[model samples]
Target chain A: METINYQNFRIEAENICVDYNGKVALYDANLRLKPGQICGLVGMNGAGKTTFFNALTGFVNISKGKIRINGESLRSAQKDQTIAYVPQNEGIDSQFPISVWDVVMMGRYGSMNIFRCPRESDVQAVKDAIERVDLTDHLSTPIGNLSGGQRKRTFLARAIAQRASILLLDEPFSGVDIRTEKLISELFIQFKKEGKTILLSTHDMIHVREFCDLVLLINKTVVAYGETSEVFTPENITTTFGGISPDFLFGPES
Target chain B: MELFSFLNLDTFITDPLTHDFMRKALLMSSLVAAVCGFLSSYLTLKGWALMGDAVSHSVMPGVVVAYALGLPFSLGAFIFGVGSVALIGFIKQKSRVKEDTVIGLVFTGFFALGIVLVSKIKSNIDLHSILFGSPLGISLSDVKQTIFISLLVVILLSIFRKDLMLYCFDPRHAKTVGINVFFLHYLLLTCLSLAAVVGLQSVGIILVVAMLITPGATAYLLTDKFDNMTVISVLSAIISSLIGIYVSFWLDLETGGSIVLAQTFIFLFAFLFAPRYGIFKLQKLFAGYK
Candidate 1:
């Protein structure tokens, strides 16, 4: 697979708003993403990164907003299975007594007719995902037994198996070992090369400074949106997290 | 002479009434086992113990309604059970109240209404069958009712097995994968209501809860996979059924009580001694290795 150049909008949000229990979570949040790029959403806790993702994916209702992918609405993308969302945490109960292979196989469900059973191609896709994520060894193991990093990798395997055109990831690097984070970062680069659009949220400065093509910093509002090098200035770092020295962005050692 | 008559083939075989009662009991018991056994796995997975209780108890009003309307009793139980489940789901999702609170609220209110209805029709109706079993009193008509509901339940389950599996395990993920969470949730509740309606006569309210729950919970301790858990649940239910009936026949005990007692034994077995996920298994592993 070859990377497509950034072109027309693959994902767009206009005046998106969401409210939970009468408390506004996200208000008139506007975002746009083009195909074949890796974008990072860097935000403080409760800065509405997840809410925006949920709204774009239709996990929550779109109130007072226009969201579309590839010139079609979010509702239309749902029918086309164009957006594949990987939540902050995987939803399968850890003790559910299911295999790693089975978890990955869940990706194929979107591609299958709901009324019919999953077919052999679905199984093969899952296998390919497992092999790609270097989880061939743990294919038979129950998901509960996996380490935190392995679990994240398994979720990546699910998205890969899904073969979705757009990927929505929420903090994939959280609580993972550096080595595991490195591997996931490499995989995202590979996904970009294959012409898939990725929108991920994170607070990890290293991943942001080195890899992302676009960066959006927020604390309940979009502070900066542009190339990572342009938006990730020393002043911007101190502004996003309160009281942090500009030198802390790279730190004394670096 | 009487003892010899009890032992004689001519006496035993020629008593048509006793033979009929025995056959009816076996058919009815198996039907109860078949439905309750399989349905319990879903109930356990969903953490709806109270909902199951509510469905069973709420159907009391439905039965009363049926008596009042002069319709078939099973139809009444089904309507009330299904309707109440929908109501519970609607309230929980649509309101600020927590789910258990909603279930308790709806079930208690519906059950109270049923009590009032039954009290109104008290003289003409004997609604003991709604609360407890008359297993020895199963009629041919009861068998017909059990068969129809069980068959419908089994067929619907098989058709939706994959969606239901995902729906139970990871509902948000299920939604991501194109399974409508609300639709499947209500569909499963509908199945539970149907099973609850049929299970009323043979297993009674309390025992039906025990049967649907204990077997699946027991199976959870034994297997770490969905397919195996379902299988183990059905197997445990069947074994309990056969032994419960045997124990009842041998000792002249209540059928529902004995079956639940047997299930409790398995629960105790899995609880105390099963491996890996079981308490005993964890203990054994802790003592022996990791």
Candidate 2:
């Protein structure tokens, strides 16, 4: 394997390929994301958006190629707690007996001792994260009792509390209320200003266009990736989604 | 009225403790119940109730083998309990069979092997006592073993409470935070096996599942916090053990059956009358509409 300098980018993936039991899920995918950029990962259902996110987070093994987070290998970066991943809500068991406070506190577990007893700093970080998400009123409430938007905010707050340089959010907009969407949009801008690299996968084109400075289109591999103005075009959408009506791209008036 | 006779204060509480065997039975059963109850919270949280049942049943063969070899029963039982879990995982991964089906298949097969072994051997190990338990017949060594295993489980669980809870709640998140989720998974399974071995000695194989499930399930209905759930579960189990031991002595019933039955009754009571999540409470909240 040839070595590439990763110092210029916060996240760099070079020709990464992933296969599941002999079937290719992602192939020859390459991406480089600098700090202070919000990248929207756009793809159709089962088109490998999630697969790419999983690869970036080291949740799934890449059969070939390399991934560097902040110029460090994935394992070392993970050890340093450099990445915070907020997965889709479908994977969580909401009926679990956990509180909003408890969920957010988990983000600080990486920094705590083996016993996981939270210190003063950890508690303050969790409180700040929850207040940022506007969930201070529901801190002690069981997660199961929260509404859909509030639940989404709870997980977002967890990612916030993690204090990682890279935030990977999978489908953050789905099943969330308009207020949650607005809050998340605002949070993304703030994160960008803080020089954090944010990559989020979403099916909502309007959200992608509104919140992301860069866009990545995938259909089993990287189809197009660049400035949202130049790459998230109808032609690229057609190429990535395979002949979808143009009206859906820009809404009914288009 | 006949049943109420056993509830007399002397027979129910005072006289039972006067006998040495009754006192030992109470101690042994209470210790076993406390640990099982504590672990039951995790088992229910992880949705591993069936897994508990599978491990408990699978340990039967190990107990039989231990008896045949004149070895400590817990060692053999622990081996079989963990072996069954591994076997189930293996079969589920290797074939198209669902995990529940694999669990059911493995446990039943292992249990049948144990029954066969017991039948073939001419040892003094009674199948009746093995199936339903003999709390009153517990030897001093059995008491020491139960205490040692329970303390080990409780200490280890307390130390890793947060990590194990995170692993049970969201394994993906646990991994992202650099937690060794694979090790936690095996650690939890090992604890479950140890709990099973202890339950096997006190409640026997058949009713041990109840000891390992009911306290936690009942507490789950009564509380919304894991810490409170654990405390409630342990207290309920301890109370039920005492009541069950007293009832068994006063009514001349099977000790293990009475203990499990007592736990079931508590679960039923909580299901009907719990403050927030009970069926009757919900019904009463809407009574004005009708």
**Fnat value of model 2:** 0.68
> Model 1, range B130-224, lDDT digits (tens) per residue?
66676768767777888888899988888887788777776656665556777888888888888887777766765677877888899888887
Tell me the tens digit of each residue's lDDT in model 2 across B86-173: 9998888778878889999999999999999999997898999889888888898888888999999999888988899898898877
Q: Candidate 2, residue B217: CA error in Å?
A: 1.3
Please give the DockQ score of every candidate, comma-separated: 0.46, 0.68
In candidate 1, what are the lDDT values of residues A1-254, reduced to their tens digit?
A: 64555778888877778887566887776778887788899877888888777777777786677887888977677766677877665444677777888778877877787554568888888989999888999998887888878888888888888888899888888877777788888888788778788889887778777778998776666767788878887778678766576576457535
Q: What lDDT does candidate 1 reach at residue A64?
A: 76
Candidate 2: tens digits of C-alpha lDDT, residues A66-168: 9998788998887777899897888699988899999999999988999998999999999999999999999999999998889999999998998888899
